[model samples]
Target: MTPIFRRLLLVVFACGLPLMAVRAADPAPPPPAFQEGKEYGKLTTPMPPMVAGKPEVIEFFSYNCPHCHDLEPTAQEWLKRKPNDVQFIRVPVSFNPSWEVTSRAYYVAESLGVLEKMHRPLFEAIHRDKRSLASEDEVAALFVENGVDEAAFRKAYKSFQTETQMRRANQLVQRYGVRGVPMLVVNGQYDVRSPRMFEVVDFLLAR
Candidate 1:
């Protein structure tokens, strides 16, 4: 090759180095047999103590995150189609100020035992209505607008138990290394995103 052609080839080779390394790296292996790992069996995490003997699949979601909002329908569908042994949970991130308010709102709803009613509204309020359900007054107003009694909302919103649950959720975020919202963790054993998600679920389920 000519000297000019040799230099051009060197440039191309340098640019391709990262791609070669990426190809060299081993891809994640296929999903394992179900009932084989703790992530698949007798699911229990210390924080909040989700139901044991029942497998858990978690969607680490954040209200301020548009992607998470988009995943809502898929998550709801999964919840509907989930097996009897699988218990689904949504954990809202609390590491940032913008996300903290939404996390608190989730706890408030859980305390009221009205998750079924408020879950969609909360997401719609922030993502669709452009409302910020931040303060007690705002959350209380949201509750009133959604047919929940205002007084009841306030009572549960600031209750000690509700706050504790919120804190516990924060702990879970750290434990799970949940860097991104809308990430899926199956039975706390594996975190899945994109291509490998459902494949891993099926792999574990077959066992």
Candidate 2:
């Protein structure tokens, strides 16, 4: 071949090789693994919200539930990193008369502004320490140990506001048709199950 043609051919071959290599190196992004209905189910009748505008992420749990105790750490970690727009709410489930006391403890702690302090300890006291926090008095003692005054806890536990919150929580739980503890409800629409709990939540949020 002529010198000019040979040089042109070499330049074209060098340029073509890089283009081919780039095409081979890049791959398509993998699709999301979470699926609707399988990973999460929608609430048959969407429950009404306690607030407007901000999306709600509710954790329906009970102090007496062993499974809820097991999931506490994961839920806490997720709380630290959850999206700013999301409002994380904890609703204590009252499955029966016995669970009502534990439910009251949640609202009382929230009303007294001690939920952040008492939340984990309440779980630990019940599951880790094997304490029986079944009665109002027993739960108030745990609150006292957590820095809340016994008198204040007693007053807040039976306050009109605390009772209203407790009633609303129970109403929502029934509306959602939640059957178990540690269940996640995303934006009042999706019921997220564990193992892939946060993953499904992240997916629903993206939608």
The local distance difference test score of each candidate is: 0.72, 0.85
Per-residue lDDT tens digits for candidate 1, residues 1-207, read 899988877887878763234555788897644333432333344333278766777778877788878878866666676687777777888767767777877888887888889888888888899997666677678878888988887787778987888888888888777677777776566666553444456565444
Clashes of 2: 0
Cα RMSD of predicted structure 1: 15.1
- Enumerate residue pairs that collide in model 1: none
Residue 83 local lDDT, model 1: 80
List residue ranges in candidate 1 displaced over 4 A: 1-50, 195-203
lDDT of 2 by residue, 65-86 (tens): 9999988888878888988989
TM-score, every prediction: 0.71, 0.82
Which pairs of residues have clashing backbones in candidate 2?
A: none
Per-residue error for 19 in candidate 1, Å, reads 51
Tell me how far the alpha carbon of residue 64 in candidate 2 is from the true structure, in angstroms, after superposition: 1.1
